[model samples]
Target: MPKCYWLGWSGQFEYLERAKQRLALVVPLTLALIFLLLYLNFRRLTETLIVMLSLPFAMVGGIWLMWFMGFNLSVAVAVGFIALAGVAAETGVIMLIYLDHALEEARTAARESGRSLTRADLHSAIMVGAVERVRPKMMTVVAITAGLMPILWADGTGSEVMQRIAVPMIGGMVSSTLLTLIVIPAVYGSVKGWRMGRGPLREGAPERMAA
Candidate 1:
């Protein structure tokens, strides 16, 4: 009769399991901290919510890239997502600030002209903000994506894991540009209007900013 012995997972596997267990708690704590920080920076729940919305928009691209690259969900992939979230939030912050600046400028101009903020002015301000920042935003996306491209193509030792990490970051950066430029502005415009309890273009116009 042959005796059979059971093989157990290696010590490294045990360690990873433990780390994965802790991650359940760690993830929520980190997300809460991110939300708190956004609230503190913006001082308005509406603005903070708009910035946080970008994180999910970023995930749309990251997940698509992961699927396209045939990477499974693993600790390394999760790490890539965490990194992507941070970058997405930062991009959101920049976009919001630019839009605010443009709106403020429009408000000032309208106040000086002794006229209400018309639809034309609102659209003009939105475009001013979006166009002025396009170069810098594209520069940021290109720089980060370019830096990660080599890793995505890496074939050396441990390249598989690296490529998994880089794929999402690249795709997320690409998609996040759209989120930051289009989605963020749209949401902020809506939120700003809601906060004023009126329509974005016609009611509660730029006159409020001057006061």
Candidate 2:
């Protein structure tokens, strides 16, 4: 008898194996490019990091949905995840922009009043940015969800693959929107307040030196 060897996986498994290879290569490159664009947009590591924080939370929902739906890892799913990352990052950027605008306003107010920036000012800025202007962020998630919901229920031609693409996006939008509204604001406030707190110390250092 001759010994037999299994040369490669066949059918779906073969496709899956190849997809895994491509996904591993493509996902990281996609993320690196996203972060590069983010860094370029904000031009500050702190802000860029705050934006980057949303990506993981965004993935949380996609992974959960995929597991719940019994969907195995495949090319369509990977594409959905890639799309999710971009949208998640976009939402984060929008939230950050609002917060930055509010903070800039606060800074202008403080300068006009001849007072130093304070934690209270930062807190108020966050509230104004995240809470008051929340509709736009919510609308974004709603719009995406509404658009994809039909695909989930779609039948006949191409629906299966389309649903795979839509599922991650719908789930990710929910989680990412929540993060953009609630978590990002809190984190942004804390980071900005800490920087503001150190400002006084640095300013006072010159006085101490003069004394």
Candidate 3:
């Protein structure tokens, strides 16, 4: 019985290896192109850098969870990570857009109130932006997780394969969603600080503009 089980496991591993090799070429090239596009489109070094930095945390968390689950690094897991990159990017884009809108609104409000923009205003803007955006963001994550729940919990008929892919994706999505809301803001703030501290770049800008 053990011999038969070993043979079956070995066969499964061999099949996974072949699938991985085929996927490897496509995945790396696709990721490279996506990143290149992001870099080109954003233009600003600080903004681009923040996006790049925040994007990988999700994969890190997903892979960490996979390891904890004692799963081998299979092609399914690789695919999950690839899918996560897109998801993380989407979340980042949404957060950044909302942040920008919040800042603009705050600046407008400050100007109308005869108050100069200051660091406090910037912080308040971000807080307000986060609060306003939280509902949609949470809903997005919940909806995605809910949609994928069946595959994650599915039994029989390709369940093993589904589990492998779904587990990492779910983990990555959840972790990335939280990090996008929290860590990305912090990173944006830090970058804003460094830029402001350099002086001229921040010249004429409201002192309150945090990020």
Candidate 4:
């Protein structure tokens, strides 16, 4: 046989290598931008951290589903995760919005009555805010799942890539919704309650919380 010659990468592998390099850079940048936006929105490190917690909750399902489906880490899967992060953050924002409103309303009522904010008041506010949001959040998850289901089941050309993208979103949305509805309220209440217990509620306290 003639002497073999070496050549540089070509085809999909070349594209994959490029994607891996870009992904390494992009993921950290994306996370930093997200943190900045969260901080800007809440104006307090505590509340920003609370909202950031949703990312882990979202990741749990995405990773689990990818493993279950026997999918490897590809550019498509990474894209799915990025998309999932966005939706998770959005749901977290919504939760924070409702919680802030309820808490502020309770604070106003307590101030009018000339009494300190009570644990009972916090419980009531959490319940009202969390319960009222269930329908909308479920609807969002359901709609997303429905749209992705087709792509997941398809076996035609490009189905593999599409399915990888859809799987993470579908799985992440379910877990994210549950956590957003349940965990977020509990955490927000705990944080706010801690703040309340530390001292008398200052007039500016509400402004510090995520609204």
TM-scores, one per candidate: 0.84, 0.89, 0.79, 0.89
Q: What's the lDDT for all of these models?
A: 0.79, 0.81, 0.72, 0.86
Model 4 per-residue lDDT tens digits across residues 111-153: 8999888889888988998998898898999999999999988
- Model 1 ranges with Cα > 4 A deviation: 1-16, 196-211
- Tell me model 3's lDDT, rounded to 2 decimals: 0.72
Between prediction 1 and prediction 4, which has the larger TM-score?
A: 4
TM-score, model 2 to reference = 0.89
Please identify model 2 stretches exceeding 4 Å from their true place: 1-8, 200-211
Query: C-alpha displacement of 134 in model 4, angstroms?
Result: 0.6
Tens digit of per-residue lDDT, candidate 1, span 1-211: 3478576798768877887898888878877888998887766687678777779888888899999988887778878888898889877877777877788788789889998766567678878988887888899999999899999877989998888888889889989999988888777766655644564342222211211
lDDT of 1: 0.79
Clashing pairs in 4: none
Q: Look at candidate 1 and give me any clashing residue pairs.
A: none
lDDT of 2 at 45: 88
lDDT of 3 by residue, 13-52 (tens): 7897788788879787977776776666554566666766
What is the clash count of model 2?
0
Tens digits of lDDT, candidate 2, 12-109: 88888888998888989998998998887776788788878779998899888888888876799989999999999887887887777777787778
